[model samples]
Target: MKILKINEEISIKRSVDNGTEEQRVVVKSIIERVRQDGDEALKAFTEKFDGISLVNIAVTEEEKREAYKEIDDDLLAIIQEAASNIRSFHEKQLHPSWMTTDENGTILGQKVTPLDSVGLYVPGGTAAYPSSVLMNVLPAKVAGVERIVITSPPDKKTGKLPAAVLVAAQEAGAEEIYKVGGAQAIAALAYGTETIAPVDKITGPGNIFVALAKREVFGDVDIDMIAGPSEIAVLADDTARPDEVAADLLSQAEHDIFACSVLVTPSEALAKAVAAEVEKQLLTLPRQNIASQSIENFGAIYVTDTMEEAIDTINRLAPEHLEIVTDNPMELLGKIRHAGAIFIGRNSPEPVGDYFAGPNHVLPTNGTARFSSPLNVEDFQKKSSIVFYSEKALKENGEKIAAFARLEGLEAHARAIEIRLRK
Candidate 1:
């Protein structure tokens, strides 16, 4: 694949960054109809979309315990370690409910509480993503979500979920498992059926159908960000290794044919070297075609005038994953105002965030990082601001409060406070 030349003055538009245009709509409509029609609609979609018979949507207790033994100890250990790292990182993010009493005898603060029930979608189709299983459940578990329900499609060939996925879910503390996928699974999670209970919120990554379903079901249940194709941007200098940067770019590109992998560097020589390294690495990757298409269509090397210029260009992109492989990445951290997550140094690759690293892999994409954030403990929990007033407190500020309410034409609100003060 030829390296696309990016001009320093221009921001290159990815040929494939078409945002939320696909199956999100069709998936959404299917989910709604399934919510209304229940088993009938769900089975039809399951058969049509997934090509699976659906007599039982919920995984049985016996089947779950059996899945544990089916997976070997080595893979199990990896899942356990990943879960531990994820748990430890999210534990630091926990917030406690706090209250304060002011001079006027008024109490005000916020109560941080976890959701009662959360639904996690573990994408299962051609391949199983145990990493996604870890990503979705770990945050909710850390947030103290009471009941975590997991759903993934059964394997088309084996007619069962991959051993790695089931084991990962078990390690992550999912309370229940469902044998469903695509838009139908989303519908069941949102509306509940005889077998599956409705959850308070749904979180995870899926195809365009799942993304669209999440978009359509937003008000009915809380959702994480509408995820796009995985993306990574490596900001490197002449000091950075060309081979490593090329490998990192391909890592995200292989995620999907549309995934965007980019490199922005101040050194033209380094850019050329990395571009050559990308070609060398692609020959060895199993998903070479997918990664090649992604890089050829959406990838590029932007030669900036300086490191400062490179950082400015990256901030505008707000990529899902950002890696700074310059000499001293720490000094450049504050300069980076955007990015869903930042990895500094040559050793800190994007996959570190994907698995063993404590930070979440599920992140905002397509420049949404400027406004949104990676899935964290906070996403599975909510905060309600607390307010309380004593008779003395109300009397102290009653007139002002009443005047403000009156200005807004809320006579009842003014009367309520005024009546309390009068007493």
Candidate 2:
């Protein structure tokens, strides 16, 4: 980690990966093939990319039973507990369709409707993320989505989705699971194949190809944001532990080489200590190579003149994950205007939110926290603006509406209002 003085011009923005031209072309072609050939295209792509032949694209009940067996009792229990926590949290976010009537007999409100179906794309390769399975599915489940489907690549050796992922999906109340991944999986989700029905929205994280595929099919079907690499920024003071901060930073760093880990603090000594501790801890991480590359490329420690300045720097960066570790972290909470998720105090580490804690871990990345938000129950639901115009109300306001429409040069809109007024 490089230590530097915080300046007004300081920025932590990384270039968003919109994918190369070649990758975009490939994704466009894949989506087209899936649209045309449907299930066969999915199978062919699975065999070509995942290197496995699938007699069935869907995960069978027997396969799910086997997956349950592979998970130990303790781990299964933990997954269930995590699912319960996530469900309980998201259920609080559910809002009922509401309306209000005026004295003139006009009714207006929002009608909240859960999506008919949703597809969660879980990444599978070097690691298994049952946590992501819970994070993505449980929110949709809480939003009252009828069909919550999961699509993850099967392991090359066993030709099955990770046992933990399967178990987590089941615990999260999602029964529809598919064994497909990459751009092909995205395409299958967007355009219904013979086996997999198309969903109203798609959510989850994946590789560059998957991101590109989501981008390609965005307008046809709603998608969660095009996520970038992971990021974490810790705003700490001298009271914070250097080793603990370093470990928390490394947690995001190990996710990818492009992952960003930064520490902003007023204490120069604390900054130096954390930088040294990060180096010391890097040697022990199993994903040391990935973490090291991430640290070398994107990690930094900034020494600010005051805690206020540090908070300002953090807001400017709008990091995905922010940890406020200071003498009084709560006092600074209201000052933080950005960040996808804020973990206050030393005890509330980022991992707690990532796994056990109720908050959704699917967060906006690459400085998108300034405008976007975390994946939550709201993402799985849509709102329809309810408008019931009574004859008396329209008679009172129709001329004003018509004049407003005429001012916009939309005669048809004016006529529509005038026609209603005449009725």
Candidate 3:
């Protein structure tokens, strides 16, 4: 990790670029084929990219039962526990449809409705994790979504999804599971095929191809977010432990070579210590090559004159994950303007939120924290405004509405309102 004195202009622009024109072009072609050829395109693409030809795209009940048989009892228990925690957290986010009656007998309210169906895209093969399946699906279930489907790539060797993924999807209350992955899977979800029905929305993280596909198909079907590489920013003071800070930084760096890991501190001594500690820890990581490349390219440690300066830098960066290790981490919470999720104190590391913590781990990345948010139950739900006016209420306000409409040169709209009135 490179260490430097804090500079506002350079620090804010440190994130690596995530776009590639080549990938977008390929994704466009894939989406077009899926939209035109339907099931045939899905089959051919699956064989071409995944190197496995599947007679059936949907995972069967027998396969799900086999997945249970293959999974260990302990792992299944863990998934259940995690799912329970996730369910409890998201259920609190559920809100009922509300209405209010005014003095004039006017009813104004909002009706909350869950999406009819949703598609979840899980990365398959080597990058698959059961936790992601839980994070993406359980929220939709909590939001009262009626149909939840999953699409993941099958393994090249065995031509099957990992048992852990299947078990997690089942536990999360998904209605159907499809053996498809990549941009092709995204396309299939956006525009339904002969076998798979279309969904109202798609949510999950995947490779660059999947991200671009989601971007292209956004208007046709709703999408959660166009996520970039993972990133973390640690705001530490002199009181913070260097070793723990180094470990937290590495947690995100190992995610991708483009992943950004940063440290902002007031103490020069702490910065040097963290830099040294990171080098020491890199020796033990299995993904050291990826982490080292990420650290070398996008990672940095800056020494600020005071905590306020550090906080200012963090706000400008607007990192995906932020860990605050200071004398009083809570004191800085009010000062933070931009961050997807904040981990306060030494005990609350980024991994806790990534796995067992009740919060969603699917967060905005690559400075998107400035405007976007973590995926939540609201993403799977839509709301409609309800307006009802009694005859007396309409009589009271009808003239003002007609006058305003006429001023806008909309005579038809004004006359429509005028018809309800005597004059």
Candidate 4:
């Protein structure tokens, strides 16, 4: 891991950022093929890349109904608990459509409308992410998204998605499920197939190709985010435990070699101790090589002048996960301005946000927290501003609107307003 001293504010911005050129090229190619060939291309690519024979491209209703029977009741209980928590958190984000009326007889309001269909891609093959299903779909359910369709590759051995994933999908309320994955899955969702209906929006995480496909199909359909590798930034002080700090950093690193993990602190002693603890913990981890490579390539440690300086550096990194493991974490909450998800204090960690915690785990990566947001119910819904007017309302504002349009040289627009007012 590279150790850089970030005693000044200027050094933080330049020192902690990454560029995303490699992801774009891969995404573009996958998008073009899917757009041209449609279903035939999807079947061919699934066989070539995933090595699964094409018996069927869609999972049946029987499979979804049997999903609950396959799940262990105890585990099903936990899934229910998690789903309830996620629903509770997202329910608070819901907005009701409304209108207002004035004595002037003008009616105006905004309407909240769910997208006609949303395509959710769950990462499949050897990796099963049940938590992702709950995170992605619960918000959409709460928001009353009209249709939520899911796609995942079946296990070659079992010809089914993981039981946990299936249960989560059923519990969180997916309207349809398909047996497909990767860039082809994204393409099917974006462009539509004989089996899969094209969605208005697509949201989920996948490999570089999948991320790229989401980016590639962006104009055709809206995507949640062009996510990069996962990232975590932990801010520690003397009060923070070295083992906890080291463990938290390694948690994100274990995701992949390109994943990022970092620790920033005002305490030089804590930095040295955490560095040693990381080495000790890494040897015992099952994913040692993955974690170690990630630490070697993208991991970092920065010693800052004060806790405030550390917060400034964390803001500069704008990581996917931020943990404020400091003396008074709540004190720093007001200080933090950017991050996909902020897990406050020593007890809170990224995994909490990943699974049991109610917050959506699909977060902005690659310093995108500076502008983007975590996936939520808001992502599944669309808003349209409604304007109504009686003749009185139109006449009251008509002259001012027409004058502004005339000044901008939009004569036709001005005439539209002027004609209304004159009548």
> Best by lDDT, which number?
2
Per-residue CA lDDT of model 4 for 53-99, tens digit only, reads: 77677777777778889889999999999999999999998888999
Counting clashing residue pairs in each candidate, in order, gives 1, 0, 0, 0
Candidate 3 per-residue C-alpha lDDT over 182-278 given as tens digits, one digit per residue, 9 for 90 to 100: 8889999989999889999999988878888888999999999878788899999999999999999999999988888999999999999999999
**Candidate 3, lDDT over the whole model:** 0.91
Model 4, residue 293: displacement in angstroms?
Answer: 0.5
What C-alpha lDDT do the candidate models reach, one value each? 0.85, 0.92, 0.91, 0.85
Q: How do all the candidates rank in terms of TM-score, highest first?
A: 2, 3, 1, 4
- Winner by lDDT between candidate 3 and candidate 2: 2
Location of the lowest summed lDDT over 10 successive residues in candidate 2: 7-16
Compose the digit string of candidate 1's lDDT tens values, residues 1-423: 344445544433343322355555576678768878887777777778778887777777777888888888887888899899999999999989999999888999999999999999989866879898888899898999889999888887656788788888888887598878887888889898877889999999887677777777889998887777888999998899999999999999898888888898889999899989999999999999999999888888888888888889898889999999999999999999889999999999998989898889988887888888889999999999999998788888899999999999999999998788777
Clashing pairs in 1: 24-212
Candidate 2 positional error at 400, Å: 1.1
